[model samples]
Target: MKTKAVRMYGLDDLRLETFDLPEMKEDEILVKVISDSICMSTYKAVKQGKNHKRVPQDVDTNPIIVGHEMAGVIVKVGKKYEGQFLPGQKFSLQPALNYKGSPFSPGYSYPYFGGNATYNIIPPEVMELGCLLVYDGDSYFGASLGEPMSCIIGGYHANYHTVTGKYEHIMGTKAGGDLIIMGGAGPMGLGAVDYALAIDNRPKRVVVADISDDRLKRAARFITPERAKAAGVELIYVNTAAYDDPIAHLMSLTGDKGYDDVFVYAPVKVLVEEGDKLLAKDGCMNFFAGPTDHQFNAPINLYHVHYSNTHIMGSTGGNTDDLKEALYMAANHLINPSVMLTHIGGIDATIDAIMDLPNIPGGKKLIYNHIDMPLTAIEDFGKLGENDPLFKALHERVEKHNGLWNAEAEAYLLKYFDAEA
Candidate 1:
């Protein structure tokens, strides 16, 4: 079958192409991608005209399909895996599919199917390790979220410590502790906020620092007043840019005591230095955003590292532990991942979506691959309106799923919750 996918040709050039699905091998499964979310990695790859470790740049102009965060239903499975997965059942791609004892186990490596396309082929080794979820939950807007949440899991597992070079784990371990989400107005920053609020117990003071007040205001859409009040965490939004000395401002806000945890979700050299300044004595700084291999260059002070006793850590897409936790939380309505999704359009809208990242501020952007399909009735709540045929169809999809979507969507949203709801 021919499926439409967002293919990348070069820098800032992407197109929607209809391509045939690859033949399924004896140890593979075919899936129909329902929804795929725009992730930083995906956005960066298309924007930079090159692929990273997760996305290989096979051919600069070969028009590779770009989408990692996705959820879909299994339509076809090979003879060797008839009972493993059934047709019509929803599923999600773990993305890090690794063969246990094979050369590609864990970090070994392999080229796999990304989520932006209509149908995908997953080999047995990939399926056994990459495929996840058995039941569907919130299918309407789940695929896009799973990938981002997995990155958070990756960050957590990195065991981030303070810049002071402290070997101890200080951040995210106690309550009444402060967290600084630098450049908090963007989608990834919002994801960090959502995850922190959903899980962190420390007196729960979150400082969302960004240059745009409008984006900060928009963060409220995902965090309802009820939810914020219940958490009792003071969510403060600041329009401080990295222009002069943003760290000074953060220290002033915290009375120069520094915060317990700092999530460097967005990359800004000065902001990172400022993070280093505001890290508490036993704090931890998490470099959540995966900056380009060549983009970051700065000097570190050995004195600060030794005296402050801080810890620094970094990670990419998390392992299986993070994905599983995120999915389970999404199933129970702990964190409202859908609220973080700001834009929804078809595959053709991908370019606009990527271009809008720097300006949109908050919320994940989704590529609705199944544009021709009708909407589910109840799923229409967050939609712009019910007039469009697709919106109405989405409303119906929500109703059928009873508040939950397919397994893929549900697993995608799981990363927002800190605790299992």
Candidate 2:
């Protein structure tokens, strides 16, 4: 079958092409991508191309596809796998394949298997590793964002520590302690906030810090303070840029005891430094952002690391177990990663949208591969309504829900929008 996809060929080279996908083997499954969320890692892979660990060094032999956060439907099932998986069922992929104990993953390694394309082949290794997840959720949008959500959940699990002298570990985030989310206005930052608020062993106080007042205000609109209070969590949003002495302000909030867990969303040098400073005794700082440069350097307080028992850690993607947890949480309504969605576009504009993702000031930007449409930010629904009839309909449905993307808006787009170009 012929399908459209964005393939990373070389350094600073990404091209959309119609290519022939191989027939499904008796053990493989075919899926048609419905929804895919653009991730920062995808942009990084495009920029670095072969320099990226997973991307193929030779574009001719192995030009890989360029997206991982995706949800699709099974179109054809192999004869061998008739009982386990069937055709026409919804599914979401756990992109962190870690296949054969190699760093290679789909979207970065496999040419015929990736999220950016209209149709894809689920490789034999993916199913063998249980990287394919069944989606019974109401919206594929939620399922697409589950990949990023799983990373956040994995970070929380990795940040677990025990101050007790015994040779043991305390799993997950420290309960009843203060937690701080630096650069918390971004989409992944918002995911960490959602997970923190919804978890059973949640922190007593969650302080979300970001420089942009507008983004912070937008975040507050989604995860309202009232909702946090209802969960017995005191949520606070702070303009970290405006603060001359942020440590002083946070100290006052925590009654002199600093944060127990601090997650850094941005890979900025100053943000990491500031987040490291906010650690309490036995505090764990999770450096969630993955830097593009191999040797990205940042300063840390060594005294705090030794005397105060503070430590720093980093992680790239989630495991299969984490993806399952994310899907379960989304299905159960514990956390809606879609709350962070700010823009929607067809797969036709995916290359430009991804290249300009860092400059685009919004949360999650969703793309539907089979649709033919331009990039549309949710905030512009009302203004675009004045001229475009399609947007006029979008304005009423999206505006009523405080400018957040909803399942209804997605259904409308699928109904009215044109199919693949």
Candidate 3:
């Protein structure tokens, strides 16, 4: 079948083109792509192209579609997996397949398997590896947000504590401990916040630190103190830049004992250093941001790592189990990952939106399949609602829950932004 997609040809070269997809094998499934959230990883892939570890060396000859955080409906099912899945069933994929210990993944490696297209082919490995998931939720945007949420979950799970005598470390963050989330107002940071708050043994106090007062204020709108209190968590928002001594100010908030856990969400070196400085004895510092340059290095507190029992670590894309947990939590309304979405638009807006993703200055950017609307921020719905009837209706759905995005809003978007409308 012919489809339109943003194909990455080479380094810094991405083109939107119409092409015929290769016929699927008897074991493959065809999916009509619905919603895809632009991830920073996609931008990295587009800029690196063939040089990217998972991308094919002959990427020019085999231009791959370039998105991973996506969801859709199964339009065609193969005989091999017919009984397990059926047409019209909504689904989202765990893009980090890690098949047979291979670093290669769908959007980064597979030519016809990425999410930035109108259609995608689910290879047998995805089904065999149990990466294809049936999404029963109302919002495909929430479903697509699952991948990013899992990544934060994976990092949270990876946090460890050293076993004093055994020379080994215990995994998972300490229950009811002080935690710090640096750059806590960004999309990924907000996701980390949601996951941090909803988990079964939630943090006692979570200090969300950022440089931007505006971003911090906006974040508070969703992760309110009341909401955090309801979750049995004490939410603290702090503008790190407001202090004459930022590290000292953060320590003061934790009563100078420093934080038990610190997760740095930015690739900035200063943030990494600051995160280490705030580590308490036996603290765990998780560098959640993925840097662009392969050789990038941040100065870590080796002294604290050994003496104070403070350990530092980082987690990449989540594992299969993490994806499952994220989906389960989202489907059950246990965590509101929709707080991470600040913008929504049509699939046609994907190319430009993705190219400028680094500068978009918002949370996740969601796209409805086959729509042609420009990128619209959820925050802008109110102002736009004052004039346009379409935005006015959208404002109602988006504003209903204190400016949070929801399935009803997404459903309205899909219906209103379709070709006929």
Candidate 4:
């Protein structure tokens, strides 16, 4: 089958290319992708070219399809797997193709098809691993968001306490704990916010700290005071330049106790610095965002790890359990994922999207498989459906009643003019 994908040819260059998909094996399932989302990993891998783990430096496989976050309906299930996953079932593909002797995983060496194209072939091993999650939604682009969200879930499940030798320290987001999401308005940071809010039990407060006033305001639009209050959680938006005294502001927010959990999502070097200052006693600081080469270093804070019982850890990739949980959370309306998506386009737009990462509106970028359909993000900036009275009424209600975040809020959020600011 001929399918289109955004293929990375060389350093900092991506182009839409058509490729012939291999014949489906007995254990494999062929799926027609409905939607996909551009992730930070994709941006970093495409931009840095040789720096990332997934992007092979040698480029032995030239023009590699560079996407993993995607969703689709099963089009053709292998005859051997007829009863397992039937055709037309809505599902999202999990992209952690590990080959290092993990149980039931198709190793990385094999050509594992991702979700960027119109179709993807899922190997029998992946199906057996039970990583694919099925859910009902209008577009698969939103479903693709699950892959990243699942990775966040897995990151939280990691034993960060063990890494820092804080044997007595218990890690992960806990009820009544303070969470400071540094760089909290960016896409991954916003994801961390969604995950932080979906803690089953609410955290004491979820603080989104960033240097840009626009981003903090953007964070406010999604996580409104009423929304947070309804969820039994407090949402605080703070502005703190990387060089300025952000720690003092964070300290003030926590009454000088500092935060219990901090998610480092971007500009990780700054995160390392603020981490030493803002982490509460026995706090867990997670490097959720992967840093670029030469852009990261282990903080020399042995005392904080030993005396203060600070825990440090990092994570990448989605697991089966995390995918399942993410799907459930998205379907049940626990996350309001639509709030995190900011850009929507097609395969050509995806190429442009990856290139525009540095300037991308600080939210998720979605690529629809059916490029012809109009981009319909559940955001406030775009005009509501003309004939759909329900959508129009909802838009008005959000703007008027839910004054916390609406069209005006979206405009405020999207304005990020001052880079030096």
Candidate 5:
């Protein structure tokens, strides 16, 4: 079989090529990738290449596929897993394979098993570790988003608060407590906001603080304060850049009581320090962003850690259970993962889209593995509609959903741009 995929050759090098795939073993399953959400981690991998822990040192000769957040349909099930999986079944997977204590994952490690491809072979380790998931969602993008959403879910679950006298700590963010997300207007930050509101034990108030007014405004439009109120939670969007003393201004929102939970979405030192100051007694701060610098350091009040029960922690990726929960929530409409998406393109566009992800200035960039379109923002659909009828229709579909991407738009895109058509 032949597959089209973006391969990493070296640092700052990626090439989109079609190559023949070897015969699949009975223990391996072949799948047709439909949609994959480009991630910043992929950008990091490309920048570091073999130097990255997850990327192989022999990538120049044995280049690996460069996507992980993927969703698609099974094309061929191996004989060993005949009864468990079937052809044409929708699928997604937990990419954090933690297989045999190795840091290798699907997107960064495997050559023929990554997401940015028309077809991929599912390794036996994925099946054996129970990381392969059967997606029951209507949209492929939603399944592709499951991996990121799971990371958000894991952050929430990983937060812990301690009791005054007990040795065991309480897991999860404090229920009905004040919460704030610093630099929260970005894609994953928005996902955190969505999950914060949708969860059973909701926070009393959620404040999303960011420097960009445009990003904050867009986030508010998608996850509105009205929607938060209806969900029995208070939601506020603040442009922290506007205030001279941002920390003092944000702290004032909690009535000077401080926030029970603080999530720092950016890797900036100031953001981390500010989040540390805003923590209430027993407050748990989650450093959600991964910094590129290995020597990244920030100063926190150790006095508060000793006397005020303040603590800090971070999570890189979610476990299998988190991915399943994310998929279930999306399927049930408990949360809308589309809130993280802002752009769409084809397999041909992936190389450039990923190479220039930082400068793109939007949310998740979705790549349909079998199409040929350039990377186009959902907001630009209306303008592109002026010249192209496809964009005209896509613009109309998304306009119906408050200028957001949805399944209707996805189905239309697949039909008109079907690679096999």
Candidate 6:
């Protein structure tokens, strides 16, 4: 079969091309990828290429597929997985396949099985590790977003608080405790906010602090303080850059007791230190961002760490269980992963999008694998509508959902712009 995909050859070398796919073995499954969401980790892999821990050194000779957060339909199920998986079933997968303690994952490691392709082969290890997930969501984008949302869920689950005079630590964020997400107005941070509000052990107060007012305003538009209040949580958005003393201003909101949970969403050193200062006794600071620099370091208050039981930790990606939780929550309407989306594109846009992800200045960039369109922002749909009827229709649909992407928009997109059509 012939499949179109974005393949990374070496450092800063990515190509969008059509290639012949080898026949699937009995232990493999064939799939037609529908949607893929671009991730920062992909950008890092592109920059580091073979030097990246997950990317193999032979990528220059045998290029690997460039995406991971993907959703699609099973086109053919091999005999080995006949009953477990069938053709036409909607699916998503946890790309962090730690099979046999190997660092190899789908997006960065695989040559024939990555997300940025029109078709992909599901390898045996994926199914063996139970990373291949069946998604029953209405929108393919929702399934595509499941991977990122899982990371957010994993961060929440990884947070630990010490019990009074106990040697062991309690897993997960504190219940009914004050929580703060530093630099939280971005895409992943927004997901963290949504999960924090929707979780069973909800925080008493949720504070999101960012330097950019525009991003904060956009985040508030989606997950408002009113909405959080209705969920029995107090949500506040603060533009820390506007304050003369940002830490003091944020601490004042917490009644000077400090936050029980502090999530640093940006890898900035200042943000990490600020989060450390805001941590209360037994507070757990989660460094949710992945820094490009290998030697990235931030100083924390050691005094508080020893005397006040404050500590810090970080998570790279979620496990299979976390991915399942994300899918279930999205399907059950407990969390709206659409809030993370800001732009949409086709397979043709994947390369540029991944290459310039940091400068894109928005949330998730979603790519439809079987279309031919450039990366375009949701906010520009209305403007682009003046030139194209498809954009016009998309604009109307997204506007109906308060400028957010929806299943209706996705269906319309496929109907009009499907490459098969």
Highest lDDT scorer: 5
In candidate 5, residue 117 scores what lDDT?
Answer: 95
Whole-structure CA lDDT of model 1 = 0.62
Q: Write candidate 1's Cα lDDT for 1-421 as tens digits.
A: 6777776666676676787776777788877776777766556666666434433355354456677778777888888888878988767656666455432221112223667676767667665664555535555355457667767655645644433344444434346678788777776676666666677553467888887767776665455445655787777777776447667777877788888777777767876776777788767777766667676854545575687767676667767667766665565666546655655555566656665566654456676665532222223443633556534444444445433334333332232222111
Return the TM-score for candidate 3, rounded to 2 decimals. 0.95
Clashes of each: 37, 0, 0, 1, 0, 0
Kindly report which residue stretches of model 5 are placed more than 4 angstroms away from their true locations once superposed: 419-421
TM-score for each candidate, following the candidate numbering: 0.76, 0.95, 0.95, 0.81, 0.98, 0.98
Cα misplacement distance, residue 170 of candidate 6 (Å): 1.5
Q: Which residue runs does candidate 2 get wrong by more than 4 Å?
A: 418-421
Candidate 1 Cα errors over 4 Å, as ranges: 8-15, 47-63, 98-112, 157-173, 200-203, 224-226, 241-249, 252-255, 293-295, 299-301, 351-362, 372-421
lDDT (Cα, tens digit) per residue for candidate 3, span 1-421: 9877878888888877788888988899999888888888888888777888999898898888888988988989989998899898888889887789998887788888888888888899999999999988767877898999999999999998777679787688878899999988998888888888888867899999998988998999888889899889989999988889999988988899998889989888899989989999999999888887668787887887778988888988788789889988999998888889899888678888988998988789987756778899888998999999999998998778789889887778777866321
Residue 76 CA error for candidate 2 (Å)? 0.8
State residue 220's C-alpha deviation in candidate 6, in Å: 0.9
**Count of clashing pairs, candidate 2:** 0
Worst 10 residues of 2 by lDDT: 412-421
Q: How would you encode candidate 5's per-residue C-alpha lDDT over 118-145 as one tens digit per residue?
A: 9999999999999999999888999999
Q: What is the lDDT of residue 282 in candidate 4?
A: 72
**Which consecutive 10 residues in model 6 have the weakest lDDT in total?**
412-421
Q: For model 1, state the Cα shift of residue 81 in Å.
A: 2.6
RMSD of candidate 1 to the truth, in angstroms, is: 6.8
Where is model 4 more than 4 Å wrong at Cα? Answer: 48-62, 100-112, 137-139, 159-171, 242-244, 298-300, 372-421
Candidate 4 TM-score, C-alpha based: 0.81
Could you list the CA RMSD of all candidates, in the order they appear? 6.8, 1.9, 2.0, 7.2, 1.2, 1.3
Winner on lDDT between 1 and 5 is 5
lDDT of 2 by residue, 76-118 (tens): 9888788899887889989887777888888888888888989
For candidate 3, the 10 contiguous residues with the lowest summed lDDT are: 412-421
- Model 4 per-residue lDDT tens digits across residues 1-421: 8777666666787767777888888888988776677776677776666554566555445456677777778889888788878888888766675534442221111243665676778877677656666777544445778887887788677634333454454545766878888877876677777777678745888898888988777777766767777777888887777536677778888889987777777756867778667888777877777666665685647798788877776777668778888888876767656566665455657777777777755577777655532333445432653676534654554456333223332222223211010
Count of backbone collisions within predicted model 1: 37
